[model samples]
Target: MTLRLSQLIGGQARPALSEAWLDVHEPATGTRYALCPDADGEDVAAAFEAAQAAFPAWSTLPPSERARWLDRLADALETRIDDFAAAESRDAGKPLALARDVEIPRAVANLRFFAAAATQFASESHHGQAGLNYTLRQPLGVVGCISPWNLPLYLFTWKIAPALAAGNCVIGKPSEVTPVTAWMLGELAREIGFPSGVLNIVQGLGPKVGQAIVDHPGIKAISFTGSTAVGTRIATSCAGNLKKVSLELGGKNATIVFADAPRTQLFETLLRSAFQNSGQICLCGSRLLIERSAYAEVRDELVARAKKLHVGDPLDAGNQQGALVSKAHHEKVMGHIDLARAEGGKLLCGGNAVQPPGRCEGGWFIAPTIIEGLGPYTRTNSEEIFGPVLTLQAFDDEDEALALANATPYGLAASLWTSDLRRAHRLAGRIDAGIVWINTWLERDLRTPFGGMKQSGLGREGGQEALRFFTETKNVCLNLG
Candidate 1:
C-alpha cells in the first residue's frame, strides 16, 4: 500500500481540502512509495489561520515555557531516530548511513540548539546618563518556512526549530519531492501533544501551496531555501507587503588547493567536498582551483577517486553514492555535463549515467564527472550544476586563484587548502564568499551566522541572526528627571 502523507493543520494530519495528491518517489529505486497532498490555496489558508490563531498565546508564553516544548519535541524525535533516518534516505535518495549518522542527528541538534536558545534568548539593554534604554526582540506572529529537497528534515528542522524556539507560530512547507520525513515530524508532533495550531506542515507543489504561503497577508515573515529563481520570486512577493524574508539560495562554490598543502589530507577532504551527496549540496565545491605546481597531481587523484565511487541503492551500506532526488534532476545534471563538452571542456572521467545492478537498474544515478580545460567564465564552471559534476581550473599564483574563486556570481562558500597561515588569512578576506574554510570544507558551527553574499542569497540564518530575523525589534527608553 502506498502511504498518503497529509498536511498538519490545527494539530491534525488530514488530506488536502482540494482532495488532490502528488506521487512521492523513492528516488533510489525510481518507484512511488507514497502520495503527498497537493495542497492548494485552501489548505494554505487553513494553515495560516491555524498558525495565526495560535500565535498570540504561543508568543506571549515565557521563553522558558517555549523552550520546554521544543525540548520535548527533540526528545520525542530522538526516540524515533531509526524511523526518521530510513524515511529521510528514501525520500531524499541520500545514503542510509548519511541520513542515520549525520542528517538526522544534525536535525535533532537543530531542535535542541534552538530549544536552549529560547530560554537564553537575550535582549539588548543600555544604561543612559539619566535613565535606561532596552530593546525587545519579539517574534513575528505567523511565519512561513519553505525548505528545499536536498537535506530534507535536516534543513526543515533548521528553519522550523529556530522560528518556533523564538516564539513564532510556523506554517512550514517541505519540498514535495522529500515530504515523507517532514510528515513523520508532524506525526511526532501530534504524538507529543504539541500545542494545537502552533506548527503546521503543508506539503505540495511550489506553485500551489508555496505561493499561497507567500501571498497570504497573515504571514509576517518568510524563510526559504531553494534555487535562486524561486527565491527571487519569493523575495519579490514579500517586498510588496514589506514582509520580512530570509533566503538561502544556489551556489557555485570553489575548492582551492595550494602546492604546500598536505597531499594525503587534501585529497580525502577534497573528494568529500566535491562529490558528497552526489554534489547536490549548495555548498559543495563544484569548482576546483588548483595551484599550477599541484594541479596535475590533484586532478589525477580526483579523477581516480571519482571513477571508483559506487552508485547504487541508498539502503546499501557499501555504496558510496545514491541516486539523484528525481529523474528530472538527473536529466538536468546530464545536460550540464553535455554542455561542458559542447563548450570545449574535456571530460577527464564520468560523464555518463550509471545503471546499478538489481533493483536500482532504473534509478537516476549519475557517475561523478570531472571536466577540465574549462576557463573561469565558462557556463559549466560558473553555473550551478547541482549534481555529481566538478569543473577543474588551474591558477598560476595566489592572485590568480583568488580571481578564479571569486569569478562566479555566487559567493556562498569556498574551501582553501594551504599551509601558509598568512596567505590563508589574506585570501580569505578577499574571497568574496560569505563563508571561507581553510584546509576544510562543510564544517559548520551553528552559533555563527550562515548565509550567502551577492546573488547567492539575502539575509542570514543560524545563531542569533536567525532569532533576530524571525523577530521585530522595539526600543524602550525611560527618563528620570
Candidate 2:
C-alpha cells in the first residue's frame, strides 16, 4: 500500500481540501512509494490565512522565545535524524550516507544556527550631535519559502528556519518531487506543540501550490531556491505586488586548477565538486578551467577517477552515485550529453546512462560525465547541465582563466586551486561569482552571505542577510536634549 502524505496547515496534518493527489516516486527504483497533495489555490489560501492569523502573535514574541522554539525544533530533528536521513535518501535519490552525514544534519544545523542567530539579530543605532537615529529590523508578517527538490529538507529548512527564527509566520512549499521529508517536518512541528498556524507546508506542483503562494497578497515575502527560469517567473509576479523576494537560483560554476596547487587535493575535490549529489547542487562546478601547464595531467586523472564512481541504489552503502531525482530530469541530463556530442565535444569518460544491476536497473542514473574539446562559448560549456556533467577548457594564463570563469551567464561560484596568495586574492576579486573558494569547494561558512551575481540569482541569504531579508527595516529619529 502506498502511503498518503498530508498538507500541514494550522499545525495540523490533513489531506488537501482538493481531492487530487500527486504520485511520489522513489527515484532509486522508479517506483511510486507515496502520494502527496496536489494542492490548489484554495489550499494555498488556507495556508496563507493560517499564517496571516498567526503572524501578529508570533512576531510579537520575544526573540529569545523564538530562539527557544527553534532550538526545540532542532533538538527534535536531531533525535529523528535516522528517519529524516532515510526519507531524504528515498525522496531525493541521494545516497543514504550523504543524507545522514550532510543534508539532514545541515538542516538541523540551519535550525540551530538560526536559533542562536535570533537572539543575536539586532538593530542598528547611530549617534549624532543633535539626535539619535536607530534602525529597526522587524519580521515580514507572513512569508513564503519555496525550496527545490535537489536537496529537499536541507534547503527547505535553510529558508524557513531563518524566517521563523526572525519571528515571521511561514507558509513553505516543498518541491513535489521530494516532499516526504518536508511533510515529516510538519509531523515533528505538530508533535512538539509548535504554535498552530506558525508554519504551514503546502504540497503540489509549482504552478498550482507554488504559484498560489507567489500570487497571494497575504504572503509578504518570498525566499525561493530553484531554476533561474522559475525564479524569473516568481520575480515577475512578486514585482507587481512589491513583495520582498530573495532568489537563490541556478549556477554554472567554474573550477579552475593551477599547476602549483596540491595535486592530490585538487584531483579529489575536483571530482567531488564536479559530480557530488550527481551534480544536482547549484554550486557544482560544471565548467573546469585548467591552466595549460597542468591541463593534460588533471584531465586524464579526472577521467579515470570519474569512471570509477559506483552508480547504484541510493540505499546501498557501496555506491557513491545515486539515481537522478526523476525520470524527466534524467532525460534532461542525457539530452545535454547528446547535445555536447553534436556540438563537437569529445567524451573523455562516462557520458552514457547507466543501468546498474539489481533494483536500480530501471532507475534514472547517469554515469559521471566528463567532456573535452569544448570551447568556452559552446552551449555545453556555458549552460547549466545540472547533472554529473563537466566540461573542460584550457587556459594559458591568469587573464584567460579569469575570462573563462566569468564567461558564462551565471556567476554563482568559482573554485580556484593556487598556491600563490596574491594570485588567489586577485582572481577572487575579479571573478564575477558570488562565492570564490581558493583550493576548496563546498566549504560553507554560515555567516557569509550566499547568493549569486547576474543571472545566477538576486539578493543575499545566510546569517544576518537571511534574517534581514525576511524582515522589514525602518529607521526612527529621536531628539536629544
> How close is every model to the real structure, measured as TM-score?
0.99, 0.99
Query: Can you tell me which runs of candidate 2 are displaced by over 4 Å?
Result: none
Per-residue alpha-carbon lDDT of candidate 1 for residues 382-438, written as tens digits (9 for 90 to 100): 889999999999889999999899999999999888899899999999998999999
Q: How many steric overlaps does candidate 1 have?
A: 0
In candidate 1, position 450 carries an lDDT of 92
Computed on alpha carbons, the lDDT of every model, listed in order, comes to: 0.92, 0.93
Sliding window of 10 residues with minimal summed lDDT for model 2: 259-268
**Candidate 1 accuracy as TM-score:** 0.99
lDDT of 2 at 287: 93
Report the lDDT tens digits of candidate 2 across residue range 1-481: 8979999999988788988899999988899999999999999999988888898899999999999999999999999999999999998889999999999999999999999999999898997754999999998898999999999999999999999999899999999999999999999999999999999999999998899999998889999999999999999999997999999999999988988887757788999898899999999999998889888898998898998899998898999999999999999999999999999999988889889888878889999999999888889987889999999999999999999998989999999999998999999999999999999999998999999999989999999999999989999989987
Steric overlap count per candidate: 0, 0
